[model samples]
Target: MVGAFHGHAHNRRCQLDWHPMYIDGTGHMEGEGCEHVFSASNKLARSTRHASVFHRHQTIEEHFAFWDTDKYAALSNFLRNHYREALTSIHTLTAELSVYPRLEWELAREADNQALTTIPVGDLNQISAALSQARIRVDSAYAKLQNAEALTAHVEMQLQVEERWAIGDDTYNKYKQETSLCRYCVALDELECLVVMHLFELSKLSLSGTGYKLRQQIGKALQRRSEAIQNALSCYNVQAAALDPPRPSLS
Candidate 1:
């Protein structure tokens, strides 16, 4: 199988035929060589070079045992994060592809129209294009409004409010709870994305052969990301606290 780095430069056919991710049973392996392991093990050479054969073997064994244990501890978290990432990618791609059919139909119609006659472009065409864009924006805004209204109506119905909804009333409290839950969920999603991105950036910094300048840049980027993560966490906590049964705050 092609290594993860080189696979990207290959043609689509080569990738499909040789990339580890595309190949069955490869699972999440990147198809890269053991360069990272070799680099890490190189650190042990300074201590092992003068040691006895027995001590060298023991040290190597101990090192790898610790490595394995650490990896095992993190395995579940790694799998869960990757699974979420895969699902997010799939969902995003599916949403993007949803437009393909309408686009194809539009293309087909245009082709048929062109085949019938060559149309001239003029002010009328520009007006029609502008109008189409305006219409699309209006439709999008209307959809958002409808969604908001539906959510409000659903909350109201669920609370079964017959009297005036005043502050501190049960109906008002339930409405706030619903809104708070939605905000909390949104904040949690944002926090997860930020954390995943921060970890991914940190991992890149750990890779062997990273230049000093690149490492410094990554350090600066991480500092900014840390601030962002803190802000997101604060937002999450605020939303969580607004819940009827307040959630425990994260550190």
Candidate 2:
């Protein structure tokens, strides 16, 4: 089974076949074994860069030996936390499923019923019936002329004010500023979810068991997402500048 983190990066169609969520007997393993060790040992590269092959090998072996001891020492605490997390996830999912316990056939039938209701009629029978009633009301002597005149005036006012408010108008500009502020807020929210959450996850990641190629892929993803972050930031700043009072732009 693919590791949870790598599996998430796969295409949605690919996930159905490979993701741990869809796979049985995978347990709760993140499959990040020894990645934490590899990340911490990056500093060793500087010291070993000039060393002989024997010394380099010795340093790596020593580091792994220490890492294994530390990992074993914390094994109990790790297992305890994972158990709690698994229980919490199971309970939450169970509650949600209970609230909306729908079967596949039920959902399919509901969708089919909705599709049938939406099918358009080719005739104007409904429209003709409505027009006939409207004509009768208009011909009635007791027809409320005052109410009709008020409605007409209201519609004219709307056309003059709401419909005619062009780009340069104050009302239009105010709404435009509001829209930009909304976009800025949405962008900030996305950044928080993507950057902050990913950073926390990466802090606990280990790449040792995942291989060098996987490490390179993760590195490239980091670089690529940095560009996306920059673009979002740029968009935020642009929107900020368009605000009514002009929001303070990010550095």
* TM-score of each model, in listed order: 0.35, 0.39
**Candidate 2 runs further than 4 Å off:** 97-251
Identify the leading candidate in terms of TM-score.
2
Residue-level lDDT of model 1, residues 152-250, one tens digit each, is 665566568566679999888888889999999999999999999899889979899878887997799899999999999999999888887999888
Model 2 TM: 0.39
Could you tell me the lDDT of residue 12 within candidate 2?
56
- Over 1-251, each residue of candidate 2 has an lDDT whose tens digit, in order, gives 66676777876556655666555566666666556566889979856855789999999999889888998999999999989998976864554445434574356445444533554445698667656655664564244466466555665664574455687999888888778889878877876766874684365347446656656656666777788778878877887787778888885
lDDT of 2 at 96: 41
lDDT of 2: 0.68
Instruction: List the lowest-lDDT window of 10 residues for candidate 2.
Output: 112-121
Clash pairs, model 1 backbone: none
Segments in model 1 whose C-alpha atoms lie over 4 Å from true places = 1-164
Clash counts for the predictions, in order: 0, 3
